[model samples]
Target: MKNVTFYLDFVSPYAYLAFHALPQALEGCSYRMEYRPIVLGAVFKANAVPSPAQQPAKRDWIRRHTTWLAEQAGLTSFAPAVNHPFSSIPLSRMALACSEDGAINRYVANAVFAHCWEAGGADPLDLQRLEALRAVLHKQWQPTIQSVDDEAIKQRLRANTDAALATGLFGVPSFVVDGELLWGLDALPMLRARLLG
Candidate 1:
């Protein structure tokens, strides 16, 4: 199977879009997705770039684009996040905490995105949100709350972000397949073709 490395941040609406789109795109392809959590802020800082939300027009555009894409993708359940560019630090840590040897890690990651992304401006790290995340993981896998604060998890996420930048990833929803970088949710078809042909 072709291996696809998914670089994701829960705060990214595009990443949320890819959460639903890529699976459909690669339905028949022989591929394995390896999900990793990275700090988008770290990526921006490493590149000395400002986040799109920092600009008024770009922020507005993202709002519209994500909403429209969600509808086109038949994901009407998705709404443009009202509070974008929210701090993803805690959510990233939760993803790292969810990491394991099997697919439940992906479940935990997606659950975090599902829980927080739709609310727009919702605080993902609030006590209530944290407990909700805990519930999601605990439902299937036993996750220690301390895992979020583990030094190994911290280093792991930091390394993931650095590795992503090394691969020329400048944004979320990036797929690195066989050393090829495909950026954005719109790049799903390219990834699908790579897996198919």
Candidate 2:
């Protein structure tokens, strides 16, 4: 069977970490991750919990904490988005569109991760970046903000977030395997184990 579905957002550091860890953790496992972009902010609002970036102290701690987690996990450098808490709608919309594009979603995911995590994303969800990504993915995207403002794209993004909640997701980088939900990068080892079993 193919891999479990991974729900994520560019605004989430944990999601960034998970993208790096999953391949190794699931090595030799006959499963592939189906990536779905969802706005973590919407998930937070649904759960009645503010995103970590919404609070100064929590945002500061997430930076420090993920750095330490990265070191322990022997993963890449954890560069928190220079533009923490930027609206992820544009990125999310592009991802939703890529979902229907064969194999283009992989490139889209990589581009989003690189921009929001490693590259010091001082401008989150910048429309130009989305347009560029759309071009590379061979999708049609207007250069203006209207590119992502289409009602269908907006609804698709909203539906993705709603699907995440229906699966009991409370955060980004969550894996849904056979109806069992695993949240966060820390769950990778457990995910590997479950995949084996």
Candidate 3:
């Protein structure tokens, strides 16, 4: 069986959009989707990729386009939070920990995106919200959240981000298969085609 690795950051609205579309997109492929949580900030730094919000014109364009895309996809709305240079390290670390426990960790990922993008929560680093998310997951791994501050775990997160960047990934919601890189939720169709073929 073939497999595709999905690299995502919870801070990206595009990643949220991809999550909602991926199941349908990969329906006919004999491929397993592996989710890899990565640090978006680290990747941006390493690749010198600028955020849309940093450029006034691009920010406006993305806001309009993202909202329209979200509506077309039947999503509520698309408004990423106001945190300049979003901090998703804690959330990404938690996702890695969740993966270790044999769970998809979509619950936490969705919650983080929803809180930051849909709910317009300024602080994506809210510990209280993260705790609530953990409760909803029925996970007793209190140390997972705390592990974000651990040097070893932080190093792993950085390494993962570096690996992702090395793949020539310039954005979030990237899917890699057989060294081919597909970027954006819209590229899911192309990914599906490659996988099926």
Candidate 4:
């Protein structure tokens, strides 16, 4: 089985939809997925590109399209962040703090994703939301709320972003399989085909 590096940031609505859809999309495929959290803005800046949200038309399209995709995937509870382009650093750092290395497991990543994008969910940085996240993760990972502030966690996110940028990955929901990069929510089918082949 090959390793699929899934680069994600919670701020992207498409990433949220992709996160929920990925398991079924690749069902029975001989692949292992490693979840890597990165700062979306950092990737954009390093690539000298603008965020799709900066364009009015594209932003509207993304919002509409992702909403539809979520419904199609039966993720009825999906909701955009309370604030678009809000600080994902807190959420990213938290995930890294709980990670075994630079890679986060699906369970921890899912909790953070749901906390940031679930319908009626508070801001990911909200203390209550974090407390709720800590409660859930504590059962398995025993994540320390204090570790989010650790310098190492912060650097791990930076390093992950740097590594993704070096790979020419400029967006979230990107998958790197056998060193080949496939990007965007629409790329799932292509990814499945590639993996199956």
Give RMSD to native, each candidate: 2.3, 3.4, 2.8, 1.9
Worst 10 residues of 2 by lDDT: 96-105
Candidate 4 residues lying further than 4 Å off, grouped into runs, are 140-145
**Pairwise TM-score winner, candidates 1 and 2:** 1
Measured against the true structure, the TM-scores of the candidates, in listed sequence, are 0.90, 0.85, 0.83, 0.92
lDDT tens readout by residue for model 3, 1-197: 67788888877777888988887778867987777778777677777877765688987676677778888888876666666346777777666555543223456666656766776545666678777655654473444445546665666676667778899998889989999999998898899889878
How well is each residue in 1-197 modelled by candidate 2, as lDDT tens digits? 64698888878888888888877788988886778888788788889997788799998888898878777877574567666877777777765555542122566787777767765445655667655666765553333335556776777777777888999899978999999999888899989888988
By lDDT, who's the top model here?
4
Alpha-carbon runs more than 4 Å astray in model 3: 77-79, 101-104, 120-122, 138-146
CA shift of 141, model 4, Å = 4.4
lDDT of 1 by residue, 1-197 (tens): 99889998888888988987776788989988888888898888888999998799999998888888888988766765566767787777766666653122567777888877655556666788788787777655435446667776677788888889999999998999999999988788888888787
CA lDDT, every model vs. true structure: 0.78, 0.75, 0.72, 0.84
Q: Note the clash tally of each candidate.
A: 3, 1, 0, 0
Query: How would the candidate models be sorted by lDDT, starting from the highest?
Result: 4, 1, 2, 3
- Model 4 residue 80 lDDT score: 71
Name the best candidate (by TM-score): 4
Model 4 C-alpha lDDT versus the unseen true structure: 0.84
